[model samples]
Target chain A: MTIKTSNAGVTVIKKLFSRHETFVFLAIVIFGLIITVVNPDFLTLENVFDLLKSYALMGTFAVGMLFVLISGGIDISFTAIATITGYVIAVLLLQNGEQLNIVSVFAIAGGVGVLLGIINALIIYYFNIPSIITTIATLNIYYGLLTVISKGKWLYGFPAWFGQYTQMYVFKFTAANGTSYGLSVITAFWFVLMLIAWFVLRYTVLGRSIYAMGGNSASAKRAGFNLLRLNLFVYGFMGLMAGFGSVIQALLVQTVAPNSLVGKELDVVAAVVLGGASLTGGTGSVLGTFLGVVLIAIMGNGLTLMRVPAFWYKVVIGTVILISVGASAYRRKVSARRRTIIEVE
Target chain B: MERKYSEFLVLFFILLGVIGLMWLLNGSTFMSLNNFRSMAFQLPELGILSMAMMIAMLTSGINLSIIATANLAGIIMALILTQTIPPEATGPGGIGLVILAILAGLLVAAAIGLLNGFLIAHLEISPILATLGTMILVSGLALAITKGYVVSGFPPAMRAIGNSTILGLPVPILIFAAGAVILSVILQRTSLGARIYMLGSNPLACFYSGVNNPRVLMSTYLISGLYSGVAAIVMISRFNSAKADYGESYLLLTVLVSVLGGVSAAGGFGRVSGLILGLIILQIISNGLNLMGVNTFLTVALWGMVLIAVMVLQFLLNRYKEKRRSI
Candidate 1:
């Protein structure tokens, strides 16, 4: 009876491991173990919290990208959107001397995001331009306009509440070494954003429509899904996330530098694409994206802990993207071949 | 043919409009010989890169790795120049070394292109994803090798390709014109070029029609890479140095130029002449902006605006033509 139960447990484990997210989780564990072995400090709560704090901004962006990729599109403009919106808000706050609360800040940012996202949707839908091309053009336009207007200036000296908000820890404890550490409030934002994304993608009809459009747009249209509405919602959601992410970034860095955010789109793209999100759309999950983010954060942290040169991090990330993307693409080809009808009577 | 010429005419008018605006803004300064000379000197590296991007986009694909490829190729050439050819050398041997270094750089680019092709064609990876992957990997390799430093100090003769004038025209411009001619020939005259357009319009149909689709793709990327190599030589020579991050902003400008030149983002339509006109229009805008002492960032914004404007205009024009045909 014990053997039978053990066999059943083994089967369950195997089934879980077959999932993409679980595989990524396993990779994280094994990689973390290796890093911990190399540096005893790697496993400590202090370091883990540090990693999370650093990646929260990227995590928010990844969730937005996850939506875009799932809808069979790509939006490289998010970084530019985030930067411009954050910079505008910062400049305004600096000029007006108003101590706006965090909620107000987010609302303003998100409002701006929706407006820009609608523009993206309209151009892409009405002009029949590819999402990537449209975003690339918009990215240039938004970033250029921001930089031109701002003269590439950096803004700081936020309202008094900014510090208080960012400084608030979710939980705190002192280490044996007399150093205190806790996850930052910003990480909470990331987590909440992730949960929202997961709920929307997993259970909502809108999410289902997005997936359908991604899987086969023609069929989705035929099935009565409103393509324009879907495009607007998906891209608007992306922009909204970018707005939130921009604020989180500003809070973390304590300044708004217009040029800082535009070039970092690749990191978000890599993280989402690594998580088994098909660029052609119709497949991806928040859980997988979470793992993907964790995996990348770990790799970066582990490499640093191992005393590897920072350049290798990019090499590793690049190789990981290629391998994961290549493996899935190869699998698709095999499945497609298998689906071909054969006459063997 | 009439449709093609009509597109060119639209671009020509836009060019004239920009030139007129710049002339009004800066008066004689914009029309000065020095400005024209500087623009001529400045345009080729970007133009070459744009052409490289154009070839890829012609197949409804993109090589996000074009800038990365140029950097890597330039870095390789820089390494060769710094390592083998001493900075002070001036002789046939030095020239030979320069040639050799250029060859090595081009070879590296070709290899990267082949890798991209293999991944895209045989492995069935999407062009964007595959090229993006290569872009990262190659950039990482470059950063690893250079440790984020610039490679400089080439022999004087090597810099001539960038800075020198040949029979009253800048060498870089000459090279660009020559390249444009060659590319035009290839696109207009070669069977490979015909296959590229066909494949771009519809890949499955091309495949079913007995065309070697993969071979066409491989050749396309190979030519694109070679163009990037040429651009690299010009770039490193012009700057008298090479860095992994050089021309980082050129990637978008190349795309902007391609689109402005009438290259369809969806693929299968573009021409060398149209591309030249696009290049000229952008150069004029940039030069004009500089002459007016306007912020450089605004130029970037204008490029984006121009791209969108052109796209929308084309869309409207196509719709109008359809309506006219129905009538």
Candidate 2:
């Protein structure tokens, strides 16, 4: 009985190894381990919290981007939208001073995001322009508007409470060595948001609709799914996430620069793809995206800890994206070949 | 007669619209010879990039690496003109340097384009994803070679080629006009052009008809790369400086010109004439924005709005055509 169970466990391990997500999962674990080896401080509880805080906004952007990618589209304009929204929020708070409440600011940011996403959807769905092109154009438009409005100035000097609130510890634990470790409020917020995202993606009709649209738009249309409405919702949701990310970023950094998020869309897309999402649309999971984000964040952190040149980080990222997409293509080809063989037999 | 008149009328109206907008915004300053000269100088490099983009779109592929190719060529040009050949060289040596730089640029770009074509056409990788990889790779190389620094100090003749005008017209504009004419002939009057369109429209049908679809795709990218070399020379000459980051801004602009000019992103449908018109319209909008002192942020938003509008208009037109066919 013990020998049989061990054999069964071996089979399960093999199956996991064969799965696509396993590769990304393993990469994340390995990256984390390497970082710990390079700098023992990297594995410390305080550093972990710092890493989480830094990546919270990036994670938020990835969550929305995952939805868009799953819905068979791309949104390069998200970073631009985030940047402009950050600028607008900064301007409003600076001008209004005592009158602006934190909750109201969040609400306004969400509204701005929905509007931007709606615009993207309208162009893509109504006109049938490729999402990449539409988003690229809008990226320029949004950034241009931000530059004009802000007059290229960096906005700073937020209320002291804003920074404190983002950084405040919500919980603490003592290690066996009598070292105390704490989780910041921002990290707690990120965890809660990600948990909710994971649940919605796994169990909701809208979430499944996103996958359906991406997998095959015509089939989805035949099945009575409203492609236009879904596209709008997906892009709008992406925009809202961008806005939320901006708020988090502003709170964390305590200032907003007009050019703060330039070229960030690439990083977000890379994370989503690395998480096991395909550019061809469909076949991605929020869980995969979460793991992908963790992998990328750890890779960056690990390399920095190892004192690797900054250029190698970009090279590694570019190479990984290339190789992953190549591997996915190869797997599809092999599967197709197998099917052909079975048909012949 | 009516169709001919309509075509002429459309062209006339477009020209008038451009002139009227410029006149309204900057008054006589917009029509000034100096402004015209500057505009003329600007058009060639972008024009070449636009043509490259159009050809790629025709093949149902995209060449995101075009700007990278141009930047690479621009770096080579700077190095050759500034450091390699002496300022006093004449005749064969001077010509040799120009030829060598141009050839190196074209060759490097073509090799990259070929890699993209093979991956996309043969391996079945998505064009966007494949080109994106090359884009990153090439840009990284460009940065590594130049180390984010500018290279300048070209010989007098090279500078003249870039900066000089002929008969009250800039030389770059003249180069653009010449390129447009050649491209028109090749696209409109040649069998190769027909094969390209057929392949783009329906690859399976073309393959059944004994056309080598892959070859058509490969050649299109090669031409795009060659054009990138030409555009790079023009750009380096005009700016009087070559840097790794020079053509980063051109990526979106190139796509915008292709789409707005009536080249269907779906492939197999487009005209050189329409692309030329598209280029003019885009440049005018850009020039107008600059002249009017529009806020930079608002300018981008406005451009985005325009792109969205153009795309919607194209979609409506396509739908209308389909409806007519069904009827």
**Highest DockQ scorer:** 1
| Candidate 1 lDDT for residue B93 | 35
lDDT tens digits, residues A75-117, model 1? 9999999997898689777877466777888999988987898
In model 2, state the lDDT of residue B102. 61
lDDT of 2 by residue, A254-332 (tens): 8999778877788888888888787664778777888878877887888888887665666677667767767766676
All candidates: DockQ: 0.69, 0.50
Ten-residue stretch with the least lDDT total in model 1 chain A: A336-345
Regions of model 1 farther than 4 Å from truth = A1-18, A95-99, A341-345, B85-93
Clashing pairs in 2: A141-B300, A141-B301, A144-B296, A144-B297, A145-B297, A145-B298, A148-B297
Q: Model 2 segments beyond 4 Å from truth?
A: A1-14, A29-45, A95-104, A173-182, B1-12, B80-95, B165-169, B189-192, B204-212
Candidate closest to the true structure, highest TM-score: 1
Q: Candidate 1, overall lDDT?
A: 0.88
